[model samples]
Target: MRISRLAPEVATSRLIARTSGLLTVMGGLGAIALVLGSAGAMHPGAAALGPVTAGVGLVVMRWGHRIPLSGYRFLMAAGVVDIGVFAYASPTVGAAVAMLSLSAFAAMGSFLFFALPCALGYLAELLVMGAVVVVARGDVDAGVAGVLAVLVVGCAGAMAVVAHRAATAHEDALTGLVNRRGFDEALEAAVRATARTGEPLSAALFDLDHFKAVNDSRGHAAGDEMLRAVAATWTPLLPGTAVLARHGGDEFALLLPGSDGGSALACAEALRAALPHIGTSVGVAELAPGDSPADLMRRADAALYRVKSRGRGRSELDAGGQSPMARDLAAALAAGTSGGLSVHLQPVVTPADGEIVGVEALVRWTHPELGAVPPADFVPVAEREGLIGALGAFVWLAACRDARTLSEATGRSLFLTVNVSGLELDDPGFPDRVLATLAGSGWPAERTVVEVTESLVEAESTRSVHALHVLREHGLRVAIDDFGTGYSALSRLDTLPTDFLKLDNSFVSAITTSTRRARLLRSVMALADALDLILIAEGVETPEQARALASLGCPLAQGYLYGRPRPVAELVASLTAADVVDPPAVALASG
Candidate 1:
């Protein structure tokens, strides 16, 4: 109920300031109108009230950006006084009635800017103010007062509903923590406070590691409890000056005032240590000179991606100078079209024949300063920095280029496979973009296969799954990658619109030594066979593993044994022994 407790939201502050300025103009115009009329002849007292109303308007106009949210109460009180004088400033009943109706702005502002209790308290003040104007002014009738009451109460009631929805919008229902909307507001307020006080401000983003597996394995109910448990565990550990918010799914955001990089890192470590069982990856960043909230968060996110790529369950702090080379890698990828970002093709082949049936397009980024930034590193950066779409687009473009070159050199079109994140599917225009890329590259959809992780299919997201269906309808084949590594709902397997299933390396790596894993792989292969789906075994490093796979009837496979992912030049060199290397971006394996 106490708005003072809520973060001094920037949007809320701006709304109040703008509305106050508008109210001042409204009151000032009414006062000027009365001054231009015959108020001096009718009600001599009304002539004096004109100047009184104008004075209030001048005071209201002065309460601008400099005024803090705490001063909002004073603003509402001043508006009440201004309205009363404005009604009496005019001698005519119609003019007085119009001025009285404008009082609803005050009531509406109260609800829009404060909690229900605070707004209701202001409404009561308005009711009393109206009654006083009716009793004190004999010229103004009770009917005018009644109309004013209806207008104010009606508008205030409507705003109350709106405010309630807004309150909920700022909170996460499951965790009872502030949502992304609230986190952003808190961050802005903290930034402003830091600017004024010259105090340290730090922010961190927390991503729960491997959280999807929990959702798929234990059900959504268990996943929800994990989220709530995280909130409950972390809230008590936070300082009173700190704000923690849920950033959707298993991710969270935190803001800490008076904490620099070192302290923020320490705080993040403590929180991570306190977790029950889940591992978390944290990215911490402190406010830098001339840095906005977004800049600070972006740096933190970059640091976060680095931590995730290395391995989760650790905290990485982005000191102002941290990873400057990879800070905006996605943008660099965009600019590095000729040299920085490229597609490396890894061959997917039939195990028995050792023939390269197709090439899997893997992205590689070479930062000018940080040359050869691995896909694992830059891929997360693209996703975190909102450059994933561009990255995906670039991969398609590069793959098309290589596919054309290889087809010319080898004399046939090989089915090309490219990896896509589930996040890409959320885009409504994803299919269009894919089609456009293929059409532009002159690559046939029939020869292109987009590989998505099994975890993506397992999630059962309507948008993502539907996007897969759309891709299939457009003649693009879909392959579920990292197959034994997900929370596989076997029942849903038959229903999935897929052309191939790629066995995960985790199971493949142990398949030769572990009989159980080998049996499991066989079962998956048979399952794929029953569904008329082609099965591809991945990560075949040893000759024995290759023999084992072939013996067990693996239709297709790829790995280091087939010669590692290499560039087009390397592929050409492998076939014929002339030492050659690509300028950038090519990695393909042999069958």
Candidate 2:
């Protein structure tokens, strides 16, 4: 039973136990001194017992550090021992000595227990001390017992206040869930328990899909209300052993003791079912053989990134196979610092005349052993490992330089589109960084288009919105890439500062196969026209798809039909061979 209850004590309880231990030790020693001083030579047994009890109390205080919860009980036991010793030694010593010992109990009781329990314990101690005083028939002040009672109550009240403050410190003020600090403490404790018991432990990280949009569109107050509603709804659904915490912003973390990956995923699905309107991406990772809290969290975060990358409203379990990739990526990034990463460009053209008007920059990584690691595999790894920022900056700088060179060589104003990570778009300094890169590369902002995934529209925070506006103010164009593949609504296109919408390849793939989908494509084109935004169709893999896109009045298109992603030299050479001396100005006249 003791082992079962040996889970880590909360921060508040630990603080109280430590304070109680110190108070207990002080109370024990003070009792001994008062008795010795008042008695003017204590009884041999009393002198031996007093110091021995005090010494034992000090030892217990030290032991509390290892098992804080158990230590709390030990401190309580020490208090009981002190009272018994004082009761026994009171007759030989004066009643004043007994009263002093009772006062010591009052101080220790303050932090020893909660208000009701502490009050009851102190009241019982007072009764024993009062009886001792009556039996001793020594000149004890009649008012001392009442004064000590009041002191005990006051101390207990103070302890309550301290405990409340400690709890508040660890709680999220808005959501009433554990804050990040509390989550860390709880995760450490959970990891230790899993290590000791060899039980499966899992961590889940949840990100609310498009949460920033909620804050941006409905106002922050409504966002706060939504967060609180989520917490209140989901808190009751968690198991008793699970720890739910707000992990800053629109994310929440769950620590599930004795649960494996499968169970954790189930919990996530259950949460999704409960809050159907509020989409969440959940990542689950079970504890490994030698996993620390940080390792577990990193894995879970990686899994969450995968979920978000694939599409937001789902749960994913970490395969725990990224250690090699993580290592290689770290090494690659280190090497990339001295010029290892490179960019390739894919031409975006008008299907009507196949004229190259813009180029989309794609990052490439050629590993030493792994050869060319695909962006799909390493890009998410970079985002998870905090290397995305550096990698993105490198890509932006290289793309701008290459685009500038290509335009100079062609003597034309060919636009360059660079894919920006959601992290980069959300960064406040991203607009400034783009401007700095453009300044260094001599690439005009008007010739640069920042391409972001459709998720950007959903996760549009105020800062991100402001950043987009700032980028546009500096004459940089913004386009939503992979449009139909994410949670973007056609009606909401005007809400974002988007100049172009690139239809996802999935939709393009369906355009030729499904008549219903072809109609949807036409509607999308009409909506883009209505919104006065440029529409671009991606993955026009065949003449048929391109012909269909043209018939649908889609003005811009990019796919293998034009050309695959190639090195800048090859792309420029191909464009030059196609007689592209200047940016093409062909307009589609027919479907």
Measured against the true structure, the TM-scores of the candidates, in listed sequence, are 0.71, 0.65
Assess candidate 1 and give its TM-score to the true structure: 0.71
Per-candidate count of clashing residue pairs (backbone under 3 Å)? 10, 1
Error of 1 at 172 (Å): 2.7
lDDT of each: 0.75, 0.74
**Candidate 2 local lDDT, 430-506, one digit each (tens):** 89999999999899887788888877665554556778889889888888888887555455676778888888888
Per-residue lDDT of candidate 1, residues 271-390 (tens digit): 999995889999998899888897788778767756765556799988574244445564566576665777777877667756676788887776677678777777655665545677
Could you say which candidate leads in TM-score?
A: 1
Query: On a 0 to 100 scale, what is the lDDT of residue 458 in model 2?
Result: 59
lDDT of candidate 1 vs native? 0.75
